[model samples]
Target: MTQCHEDRVTGALSVTGNAGGLFHLRDGAVIAVESAGSPGVETLLLSSGGISAEDWDAALVESVGTGSLQAALVARGSIGLAEVEAVAVAALQDGAFAVAAGDVQECVVVSDSADVPLLPVTGGVAPALLLAETAGRLDAIASLPVPLSPYRDRVVPGRATKSMSGERREIVAHATGRRSARDIAFATGRSLHSVTVEISRMLGEELLEIAPPATAFSFSHWGLPSLRPRAPGQSSGKEMDWTTTPWPPNCGRSERTSPE
Candidate 1:
């Protein structure tokens, strides 16, 4: 009996009898196995997810392009419990010494028929190595920088106050006032289209003022309305100081007695 071992990074693996072919392990999963061409050798597809042993059989037929290997291996159904135990026992009885699955660590080696364990070590790394590899991949993904926008630098106090998404806020907060859209997109991991869309939305809301092209500054000054004063005695209209000797410009003074 010939033994083979393989390691996987992300997807699953499947083995059809000695004839080599491709097989779907699961959604976004795939397995490739090479057999020793030994007669009476059986191909096994073990799955832990919703896929059943019958699904593996169909997948193998669709992928391997031949039913010769399918006829040799016995397909069995086992749920959440240890599916490996049943697969191993069946493989040993078929006078075979090699087995393959999507996960090597999950495979149980019950017999010592070959130099290595009776089970062919194929698919993802050993249980211990798998943990370390997964940690490293997660660290890389987490370390990736977040996306940002370039227009952030030109935000004037009152003008840029429109409600912005968190990503947009980060970009605006980091703006150095000199970066272009392309430059900002590169630095922030955001596409130019997304940055432009947010800027256009802010402009439409009057939160951002567009300055004329070719100007050193691209945005206009922010304007905030002032509060109106109330009348002194009535406490509602424009207030006037009657006690004072005179009033400033635009002041009207008239005294009219009302007839009862």
Candidate 2:
């Protein structure tokens, strides 16, 4: 696969209108497009076959007829099913074309041009396809009205901030072992930037320790000793020897006995 760095600010893939090209995101994630195409005119999404990135690109170009739907994929890399769903919902709300693919669900196609939903595959579609579809839908729907009015003005809304913090905590709790930044981001509902920033802050403050590969930190390995109480009246110099005295009435005890 031909790998090249895209702009970090936009998180977009830089590619010419050609076949067999790869785009690397700012988070060190790489996506190889099977071919180059426009956004809304052609099939924007292509399934990434279990092959080399170069082969994947060539297959996509051959399948889609031309390079009309490649820009969208370059903009957005492969996304999860949940993220695809979110994009689809947003796209449908705005009266635009949207597509979705899931591990268990078939490929979904929703568009203003089509009356019925289209399913390319029966069983499931790959993540790369889903991401491409989402990007295409987003591009098609960009002109429509999005229901982001309430969130458009806030620096960081209260609910969003709280949710982010909770997600971070959950990520940290489950980050017992050495996991990649991308994996943590995928697990914790956070972005790659957010995960990296939080990890850096934690490491600098000595609150978290990083282990390479599969190493993990266990709670039981902290080496703190357990505490236990001493027996009553075990000292000889103590004056309070009331163990023989009668217990309080109705104190759930019929009699009292010494330690012997």
Candidate 3:
């Protein structure tokens, strides 16, 4: 992501799945972002009392055929400059993380002419900077030890959070296995990143357990066997010793010598 954006590369990166993201970049900077897991900035603004739904609609009306909705909001004194910038940056970060949550193998990048209409950017961010911040956020979550490390893996409270209090306890109490971190954030008025990190920590502390994410359709899921870890003392899965390993039931070893 940093490389694509840093070289001022023009294109879009699409994570090829339901929980994926589409990021449009221009000349090494992120211009527009959309994510499946995270809601738009408007949701956060309304939830945080930063803006009202009616006012947002009015701003949309004001910007009809004009310019950026964010710009219109600022111009109309609907929100301050700093707040608008903050919201935009946060939303972008959220989208980036949401895309990242997908398995890295599933993500694919393609370059092309920048002709597609992108969501009007509230602000642009350098890809390197955006990626760095997102990595740090994920790191905060990953520092905690847990059985499941995948982002889309849901979690449920496994043990009582009786020993915890405040936000931590509140978060664990609400882990019903049906909600993703983003959903919990909306329900609890917490930031998505914070909730993700917190859930990771609680899981490490044995206050939570892993659950499968909502099932989705994919040939990989149904037909493809997932990668498994190498057996004990094995150097690598690719270097399997088929000769010494158990046979596929009654298969005989080859008696023929190597062909001269």
For each candidate, how many residue pairs have backbone atoms clashing (under 3 Å)? 7, 8, 3
Name the TM-score of candidate 1: 0.22
Model 3: how far residue 120 lies from native, Å = 5.3
Q: Candidate 1: where is the Cα deviation over 4 Å?
A: 1-163, 211-260
Clashing pairs in 2: 34-57, 36-67, 37-67, 37-68, 37-69, 37-70, 38-68, 38-69
Instruction: Score every model by TM-score.
Output: 0.22, 0.25, 0.64
Between prediction 1 and prediction 3, which has the larger lDDT?
3
The residue pairs that clash in candidate 3, if any, are 5-28, 8-27, 8-28
Global lDDT scores for all candidate models: 0.35, 0.31, 0.66
Best by lDDT: 3
Superposition TM-score, candidate 3 onto the true structure? 0.64
Q: Candidate 1 at 28: error in angstroms?
A: 27
Q: Where does candidate 2 stray beyond 4 Å?
A: 1-164, 212-260
Arrange candidates, best lDDT first: 3, 1, 2
Best by TM-score: 3
Candidate 2's clash total is 8
Estimate, for each residue in 1-260, the C-alpha lDDT of model 1 and write its tens digit: 11222332233233443222222121221222222211111234332233455755564565455433332222423332234444433332221112221112332222322222223223312433433443553344234343223333243212546677777675565444444443344455443334444554554565444433333254442332223332455332333444343334222333333322
Error of 3 at 4 (Å): 3.9
